[model samples]
Target chain A: MTETSISLQDIVLHFPKQRNIFGIISDFFRKKIRRFTALSGVNLHIKQGEVVGIIGRNGSGKSTLLRVISGIYPPDEGMVHAAGDISLLAGLGTGFSPHQTGRENALLYGSILGHSEEEMLSKLDEIIEFSELGSFIDEPLRTYSAGMKARLGLAVASAIKPNILLIDEVLGVGDPNFREKSKNKILAMVKGASTVVIVSHSFGLMTDVCDRVVLLDRGKIIAEGDPQTSIKAYYDLEE
Target chain B: MGQNGPTTPVLRQIGVKSNPLLAPINTLKEVRSNRFLVRNLIRRDVRGRYRNAALGYAWTVIEPALLASVYWFLFIMLSGNPDEMYAVWVLLGVIVWGSFSKSLNAATNSLTGNVRTMHLVFFPRSIFPVSGVGANIVVTMMSCLIILPLLYIYELPITIHLVWIPIGVLLAGFMALGFGMMMAPLNCVQRDVQHLIRFITRAGFFVSPVMWTAEMAMERGAWGEAALWNPMVLPITMVRHALEGKSVELPDSIVISSLVVSFLIYVVGTMIFSKYERGAVKYL
Candidate 1:
């Protein structure tokens, strides 16, 4: 068989738009809440080893599309096909549980990321040493400073070496030095990892990392093809 | 959609996704039941608690032991039955009930407790109940070590019937585990169940014949028989009788009914849980 990979067809995803809290308690209780459509008729496909950038605004369904593509959420209506174990880190530490220690959470989170226990163990040292937390690895994660936790989370997941990696604004967390390291590690993986989908509002990073760019707006793909053209379309539209 | 409980039927409405690492193990793949994966989840469930606790796991025994003291004090002292073998009776019930109930109570909310993990992890979510049950049973066995010594000090004669304790324990585990697996899926769908089961579990504690014996229920008339209907009472009674070497046969109706009920619950609960399992992750 040919090395075909991920595919998405006419995907529609809706999420509760309104925050369901009673600001005006006396007005109504158990009222219906509004929904915000995140993705509407989104059709895309990525071949094995293709590096794709998904560019959209905050509410433009960019992250939602990535999450759906990551197999985190089944589209409300659509067909999706992804071949190979997909690993996704939606946020800096989205998968880590606060109650668990860094050492244990690594295995727990690593397993979910699709690594077996032996796979995680063999890479555990690199993960910890990269995080540079040293003895703090034993501390309960809730106690870790936000930055420390981010380092730990990023290190463990990067060590996983996923086949298809979905990264969503992960480099937004740390300082310049850490961001450089993060970008280097990610770029290195691009050669080995079969497919990668990165979502960022920053056109610069999109240009730097992705082979092709797809611009999304209000849940629909408005323009897709060249990195520069999509960037021009995104900025010109904003203008 | 669910009828009586939270079950998300995974209807393959469309095409298969390409995930080489985690293709749904349709019939068991090359993996040899990663012993470490199993150990990590279970170890996390166990050491996760004891790691930061001041009392450590000793609280496992101290917990039921403390409850035993209060019950024995109330029954033997206040009830003016100091001569009665109530302490050992309470200890025995505490031991067996401690094992299964700790697991059941933990398992009941295992899904809710690990909502984050469940949403993220792809390994069988059933591992939560299994791990919780396993962890509680370990602690229960440890408490039994304390209870066994106490049993000797109380001069209770050991007998062959105690060999059946493991069987009864296993049955009790099934009963609790079945209920737990069913509740896990339900907790995922309904947000309120976590709070609701708290009072219900407390009520369950009193009616379970844990602190007191079923014999005293006689004065309560039909209420006494009604108490036996509580599914938790039967396994403990069987195990308690077996452990005490009390020559007694359980009523045929109860034995047949409970085993069947436990079996149905176990099978149907697992079915329901797996059904909704995927949907929960989707919604989350």
Candidate 2:
């Protein structure tokens, strides 16, 4: 039996339309709800250590697929499986508190990524050095520029080695130097005996990093296999 | 609790430890990740709120100090011959009850403001509310440190009864965290819940005895007398009584009942928060 690192068979996700203030207050009084699904039916299976990439236009269920696989959103319609622990780093730095210093946030963000205090402490110097945040590390992240924040976030996420790392367009962060560091870190992570599933629109990023690519359109898979073929097929479909 | 949740003989709450949609721990994990997050959050809240160069740490004490002065000006100075004991009562209630209500109110809004984090990662969502209380406690403590010196400067006698302050503060934290957490997932799905918290917390400001005396509350008949039966009222009263060097008078039943209420809130809040915290993220 080929070992599968993560599996999703006929998965579906739905989100309800948001409520305005009036609706929310009424909800408190009435307490009624009905959810809407975002993904109709999706099927995917990733083998161990596979660098599978998911590509699609906006709202094409690429994020939903990754979320379901990483166990963020449970599929209403199908079975999802992972052989071992699964860690998701979907949007780097999204989990950070804005008013906190980067150094302190490193511990909080690191914990969010499943690192214990000791592990976070041990890796603190390494994380700070890797991100090259320097003196700004002691300042609240609200003080950092967007790119600086992204670098800090990515650094924290990468510090914790997840068994099945899920990336969602995080490669397009920071300036040239920081982006290079992030890419190298990603490459190093991919080389480990762990699976990675990335969702990105950048054909170069997907082809350069992914072993194979799956194209998604309108919440369904349009093509799969070689990155070049998938890219060409996606472009053809778009045309 | 799952394999990743804490295994402490005692835990703060379930969702704070594990849930299938979030951290998904079952007790054995005993890893203190969320606690670490809470500590950082509390530290950051205290540090960031005070780090402004103009007033710096004095900012922590300023608001309460201003309120106290204004209150003293109106009630004591205007009336003439104000007792030190009454000032102590006002100080205690102002600090403790204000902190508790603020924590709960702010906690109800924690999940909303951090929607970016809420959408990207899953942990016991209860931690958001807990972080709010934790921050409140840190801020409250810093303010209290400043308040005590003011008491000494003002010539109010310090007593051993001051030791009870920590316990009183803890109970307040538990109460706010319990209620805030119960309302958190609901707030995430419903924005008006935040507004409702504002309305009610303001109402709480008047009813919570923060600015009033327990003797006054007792004089109001069934509703007021009936409330010393309510757990929060007794504690608020106790804080005032303790600060004034009065005997710590609390009915055993009230203590037990308040603890029970706090526990129930923690239980129900965890169950409800876990049921919906993951699902609520999509709405955000």
Return the top candidate by TM-score.
2
Given candidate 1, what's the lDDT at residue A26? 26
Candidate 2: clashing pairs of residues? A13-A38, A14-A37, A14-A38, B1-B25, B1-B26, B2-B25, B2-B26, B3-B26, B5-B25, B6-B30
Interface RMSD of each: 10.6, 7.9
What does candidate 2's lDDT look like per residue over A1-239, in tens digits?
Answer: 24666767776667775455566566578776445567777777777658888988888888878767766676667777775555666678765667778998888778776667888898899999988888999987888999988888888887766566787777768899878878898778766536788887778878887888988877778888989999999889878
Q: What clash pairs does model 1 have?
A: A82-B17, A82-B18, A83-B18, A84-B18, A84-B19, A84-B20, A85-B20, A85-B21, B8-B275, B8-B276
Residue B216, candidate 1: Cα error in Å is 4.9
Instruction: Please give the lDDT score at residue B142 for candidate 1.
Output: 65
For model 2, the interface Cα RMSD in angstroms equals 7.9
Q: For each of the candidates, what fraction of the native contacts does it recover?
A: 0.15, 0.31
How close is every model to the real structure, measured as TM-score? 0.81, 0.85
**Worst 10 contiguous positions by lDDT, candidate 1 chain B:** B1-10
- For each candidate, what's the DockQ? 0.27, 0.36
